[model samples]
Target: VASKSNLSLVGGNFTLQDATLSASSGQINLVSVASKGEIIPERGELGVQTPNISNFTKLGHIEMINSRAETTGSPSGGISIRGDQFWMDNSSIHADNLGDTDGKYIDIQTNESIQIQGKYFGVISNSFGKGDAGHIFINTPYLKIDQGTIDTSTKGEGNGGNIDIKATKIDVIEGGIIASDSYSTGNGGDINITATESLSVTDKRIFLTPEQADFTSTIGSASLDKGNGGRTTINTGQLIMDGAAISSNSHVSGDAGEILINADSIDMINGGTMTATVMSQSSGQGGSVTLNVKEKIYITGFRPGLSFTTTDVFENLQSAIVLITFGTGNAGNVNLLAKELVVDNNASIATATTGLGDAGNLTIEVDNLYVNNGGFISNSSGGIIGGKIFPGFGPAGTLKITANNEIVVSGQGAFSASGLLTNTLVSAPGGNIEIQTNKLTLADGGTISADSLGTGDAGTLDIKANTINLTDGGNITTSSAYAAGGNIAVTTSGLLFLRDGQITTSVGTGVGKGGDITIDNPIFIVMDGGKIKAQADAGHGGNINVKSNQFISSPDSLISASSKLGIDGQVRIDSPDMDMAGFLVILPGGFVEASMQNCNTRDGSSFKVSPRQRTVPFENKN
Candidate 1:
């Protein structure tokens, strides 16, 4: 199998199968032959050497089945051809090494009457070793990839490119599967189609998600992009990819080989999806991307998410386009932004395997966005999408952003409990927010609404395991239609302070314990420009209790606690102006036998008319 010098010659007619033509470190060529004559070289190995190249015209009737040819050593190729008229069936060329002493590139320069089609995969290395001139092109003829897959991992020690067709017409059929760029980075160069060629890639899916490769150092994983599928540079020529799918995983690449589409006019159409991108770090001084469609641009399936994670410091965008047509074959007007973008709504991008490559710094600022159906957006890497999900938290890694005219949120577990989405609100000048460790207070203009579903104040609207403090200047309101304010739940085992604003709770019956409106810290609740109104008329006793360190309040303010209440610690009844309406009912045996001097006007009709009260905490003995 070491045919390092197998140069087979095919002419007028020939047939060879199950034979291994191992042209290792050698050349395989075809001399000038007449048209209509054929040559068949089928199956087995061909050029498994250093630099296996095929030069000249008409290497006709070639059938490659489960066969392979690759560059051996550091200066070779699997099968380098400059021939015409081929029917390469299920063959592959995995160009692993390149640009050594033998050759730094693999070039296929030909011009003739031929038909190139069939299954082709692997590389046309553009970087790695020989970072230049490692390309593939069938000069001028009708070339077709009936049903095949062509990809590359053009990484360390790789050659030049995947395919470069400077022909009249080209058609690509993806065999109903995807042409993926799944590695971390370093997918061979781009696919460039020059000339007035007609191109088409049949309906197929593709992806370029992050790879789980272990590149200990960033350089070890040095790659510009997954794969620049293809970009066209037309100079008064028509370029079309009717049905095709192009996707990329990582964002380590840029404008496919600078597909300089400097055309006089172009007609682009796509019924499929096209999403090719380069990683952020690799885009050299990245600039804005815009795909300009001068002539008719047609688009069919509008895919879901499309945006390369590029932070180009350039103004405007460097356009990328995928025009489409309707079922009538007529041009379907495409409303584009100087640049054209097409998304196959049918395509679904996969999640990441590692934490590092969770999301792309991709941002889309659209003047208009429409949702055909109810859609959702979620994340796993626990990333932040907005410019800065959280302020001052930078190194948190990849972020995702979604900005639309309208948004809808439904589903129980759609939004995770761990994820807290705080509106990017800027406080008005001189406006303030206050927190009272003692109790809860709401200002006149402040508002607090519940984003929960149940009727039980889910938890404490304001929870201070210890104590809370509130100075005030903002209206605070907890309006829960189904749930109550569970407002100011004090499991703190300390004091609760209520200074201002109105306290309103709307909840049904529940066996859960809510905040006890009793003055406990020095155990005193004080109120000035506020009111406490509680109603337990539905067999649910909700008492409103306020303790004051130094009882002082406005006379017009209403402090009403109409349910059963008790004070075990201390009570400072110094508010002579503010008349407290409501009875203080202590629980059965809830308080230790005690009586104070001038112990208020205890009504005989109250829950408790005795002079006994509790002055100790749950832990203290009587």
Candidate 2:
């Protein structure tokens, strides 16, 4: 049925089987109205305020199959289907505007559940003229979309309308999409979803044919041309995404949109991704991605306890990735705030720049952070694989991590912000890495480094924690090849222990000087074949200064500042008491020298030791 005025179907149950409904400038309302003493009220007129429903209409499954409902005009009013339960299979419902006016809206409200199935099922609000598209509001207790799409798009000069959905539980599976895209020079619309209980988007067909799972079930926004993309925000109690994505991107010369998520807990596994990126051909700046969780955020690369026989590990990596590049524009930043953040099994949070603009920063604020088993958090430039050289132009951005409780990096996990070396002629300097936590631990070949292999100087390492422990071949270094080495400054309150670990810097054989190492703590111990050296092969050696209450070195642990050909650097230790098991050199409150036999001396080869008390001075020659 087609009508110019409003259409009202007041009944206990409504079922349209292979039927069509259309209203060209008016709304179609399917609701139940109350009657008083057998005096029935007349249906409300178009463009007039209608009486609200006296009570919620209870219907036995209002099903629409193979039906089409559309409203088309200059300023159209859409369809409103309110029932206890709703289902649409192989159907289409649209509210489109053809003239230069804003389109109409579509509202579907149900008290129990709403399900849409079939491959050709769609619910759209589109605009073809120079006006904005209409909005789509869905309110239900449970919503499930299987192989269906809910879209709001515009092809004119006006912006697209927003999509707002609120449900207790939502599941979007099997190539389902809820998108807001703009194809013209207009900004895209926003997508906002709030699930009170839980929200999940996945593809279960991946178990049968793993290659078909390469696609993603997405809820996103996009801009095709010079219009900026719109934002996507999701607030849920718990979110589980497997083989799905929530993103916002720009393809042309427009800025990408932001993606913000707030949840109690989030677990993304099996190649699920959440990103905000600018496409390769666009010159627009990348958008930001912010995630705030109350409990924890777990992101892993592969499926847990799954033994795959395929050779493609790239298809199973869950990525919380963000990018702002492919053109001459700077990339966007990523900020994650949670109580505990765990990124394991090669899951990564990276920000890089391949164009002329600089890379974006990555900041994480958490109570505890665990990055292990090939997990990485880095900000790098010169995007060449296998450490190959490229022509670098832009400078890399910094990485700042702040943890309230503890931070752990183990099992080949790396936290690096190193400058990539271009072809030996020109190179950008490495970005700085600043980490502040209560306790920092690195073990099992874990590394935290900032090196410059190019002509630019390396960035410094500034760490402030309560206690720092590095063992089992873990290292914290800052070095440069042609430029001067970066400095390392550590300030801990309790203890700084290094067992078989290294905290050192070396200068190149050129004119660059080595960087200094300064440590200020209460107790500093380096034992079991640990070395703290600032050696310069041909350049001038750097200084090593330690100010602690008690300094102990045992079992072949060497702390040296020596030069091979240039001047020998100075080693200054100012503590109340010092203990070296093999050799004892005591100097009290005055400058003293401890000589070593068969050592080549340069212009200045002196070891200064100043204690707190005024006691006897003894120099030992070994």
- Quick one: best lDDT, which candidate? 2
Candidate 2, number of clashes: 0
Model 1 reaches what TM-score against the true structure?
0.40
The residue-by-residue lDDT of candidate 2 on 450-553, one tens digit each, is 67677767777788889888888767787777777778888898888888877887766666778788988746555567778887767788899988877777
The candidate scoring highest on TM-score is 2
lDDT of 1 at 292: 43
In model 1, how large is the Cα lDDT of residue 429?
A: 9
Q: Estimate each model's TM-score.
A: 0.40, 0.81
